[model samples]
Target chain A: MSEDRIDIGGIADEYVLGLLDAIEARQVETDMESDPDLKAAIAASRDRFLPLDDTAEPTVIGDDLWTRIDAALPVQGAAPIDVSRLTANDNRPGGWRATALAAMAAAVILAVALSVNLMRTIEPLVVAVLVNEAGDIQAIVEDFGNEKAAVRLLADFTVPQGKTIEVWTLPSPERGPVSLGLIDDARSVRLDGPALPKPHDSQLYELTLEQAGGSPTGRPTGLILAKGFAKITR
Target chain B: MVTGAAPDDLTTALAACAKGDRTALRGIFDREAGRLVTIAERIVRRRDLAEEVVQESFIRIWTQAHQYQPDRGSARGWIYAIVRNRALNLLRDSKREYTVEDVELLRERDQVDHVMAAWHRLDRTSRLHDCLGALDDTKRRGILMAYIGGYSHGEIAGRLSIPLGTTKSWIRRGLSALRECMA
Candidate 1:
């Protein structure tokens, strides 16, 4: 669709004004994914109304609020590990038995340290936030550097009587859409996909409503309920 | 808006947070939590719920910091968008009603005062101030009521004693005029 064809009858303004109901708002968001002009309009509207946000006087927050937020934060591999205890026993010297025990303990500590380093280094090669046609976030796809990817559903999706939601990714133009796996229901699950190539940034990932068994054509053959472009997660 | 921290600082802080720097997230909280709480409170109208919104918003900022595109919008705007969206969602889900209690009535009246106060606070030398100043009194009030107080169309009509359809048109035309004037 052409940008000029979009009706600019202050729909963006209504959206920013909180006048649109939940469903209408979601439809606007969904349309925005494919319409740059609409997205720009909404962004402009938000920018224009931002000054009103400043009119609010800063409300004093309870001290416990920050503590609660901190506690709820996801583990981002920055957790502190007390290494002092590991070195505390180093200064002690004894017989061969003590030396062997110390060596064993040192090995265990080294293994733990390596695993932590691995955890720090290993992250999803790319991430995608899948949104349904209504623009509501439905699921998230995380493609590891290997032939493994994880799909976590953010919202419940109703599967039809004989339909299943199949996850697909386009590794390259030559290799159209490849099936990662079939989702039985709306739940977080990992897919052991066929080895093709490493998922690149902006790679397409989608969930299509297909037959209960799976797509017979080994490609996306049904309605694409949710889709998103992958973002490189460094 | 005059942020205590510069816009560049917020952008840089977001980048740092994306790199797993917890202290950077803390820096954002220290600078913007109070104002964020206030914004959420305006929409949700409850201290505890507003605080919850801010907390959830900060968490989103932490997790989705990587998604922030510098070319798209200001970091401060992005942060405010998160807070507003969360607060709006909460308000929508709860489907709050405006009661006729004395305190409720007092708060409704204050919404008008808050909106006008914001208009008055806008820098006179700025284009936004000039554009908004150019709007009709009722039209401008309708726009402000929605943006600042998060009032729905029906609520604005009820408060302003106008028909719902009129309220919608006033706001729609008011926004269109504001955009053209600013442009």
Candidate 2:
């Protein structure tokens, strides 16, 4: 917890006010992808300044504008893969319906565990039920929103001679996938990962098979053995 | 004239967008486009460019609707953020070609008037209106120009004919003060 300190100066305010230079502003956007406090600060500032936006007169949009926009929309019904909504009744293309049931069961167990442990432990900000390609529940990830996350493996993996199971999360598009930590013995452990924006609904979490130390690129380069989206804890 | 769509309706529309409902996107457009265009036009200063910004923003909204987290903030705020960022980016990339002296002499009046109009329009009873009333004139004006006009630090300083350092401090301090007063 000693490492929880952050010093972003007042850039959040400047960022929200549109005062930072272009480069600095972009940098702040990148920083917010991994810094929850900064994200929250900027969000707060944006909300506060929102009243100013309402002052503008609502001018009529050019009639052709919507036509242009309508023409440019992505092809309908080609919805992007949204694993967060994967459920036992999903009739979507992916044959995920089978394992989704197991995933739900795992989530039910997690919910009960969460309730039973409510008064005994720090509540998680989001919980994800990781599943293998076959839809078997593989692990559970509990992100604490303090740069710390817990990985509790429900299934064993044969970590070949020099390979290890690594935990990863997609904090934002700019940050890409970040390595949370490495699991060497298939044991439950809490990983003090690098700071990240507070987990949001549908944030991706996964486990990958990687070289012993970790991916060389600081990304998930190995085979993804399990993956799921974070369901924010109530 | 629409005081923005009701928050829950907008939220529901966004959810439907996530499910690939095009009509939902249209509903949002029908409800928010007029104001979104106006908001972007203030920052970009051109109707055509502002329309372009709003158009691009809608595409993004439709594609990324699933990413909106209901618990984090209001859906209307989220949509307005998309438009504002696009408008600001367009304004920044083209660099507006205005010399500091030209900006000060020619655009200062309009910018100040723009910001002042917004401040005056704030609901008389709202905390925002009262908190802003409490700020020093310079600080309040500096904050408003940056926010309403999307002026960068240099631009705000140039528009106000103040030292760049003074403009930065005023904005930073003004925002912090505004946060405290609102709190």
Q: Candidate 1 chain B: minimum summed lDDT over ten consecutive residues — where?
A: B94-103
- For candidate 2, write residues B1-183 as lDDT tens digits: 124768899899999998888899999999889988988877876565577678768877886688777543678877898788777775654343223343344335465677778778877777788898899988888888878888878877876799999888787778778777876
lDDT for A113 in candidate 1 is: 39
Distance from true location, Cα of A120 in model 2, Å: 83
Candidate 1 lDDT by residue in tens digits, B1-183? 555678899999999988888899999998889999888877766665577678767777876787677543678887898788777776664342111342244346466666677778766676777888899888888887787777889888988899999998888778878888876
* lDDT of model 2, residue B91: 64
Q: How many angstroms is residue B180 displaced in model 1 relative to the true structure, after the best TM-score fit?
A: 0.8
Considering only chain B, report the TM-score of model 1: 0.88
lDDT of each: 0.70, 0.72
Question: B151 in model 1: Cα distance from truth in Å?
Answer: 0.2
How many angstroms is residue A97 displaced in model 2 relative to the true structure, after the best TM-score fit?
42
RMSD of 1: 21.7
TM-score of each: 0.58, 0.58
- What global local distance difference test value does model 1 have? 0.70
Candidate 1 C-alpha lDDT tens digits along A112-171:
333343346567777766765334556777788588888878678888798898999877
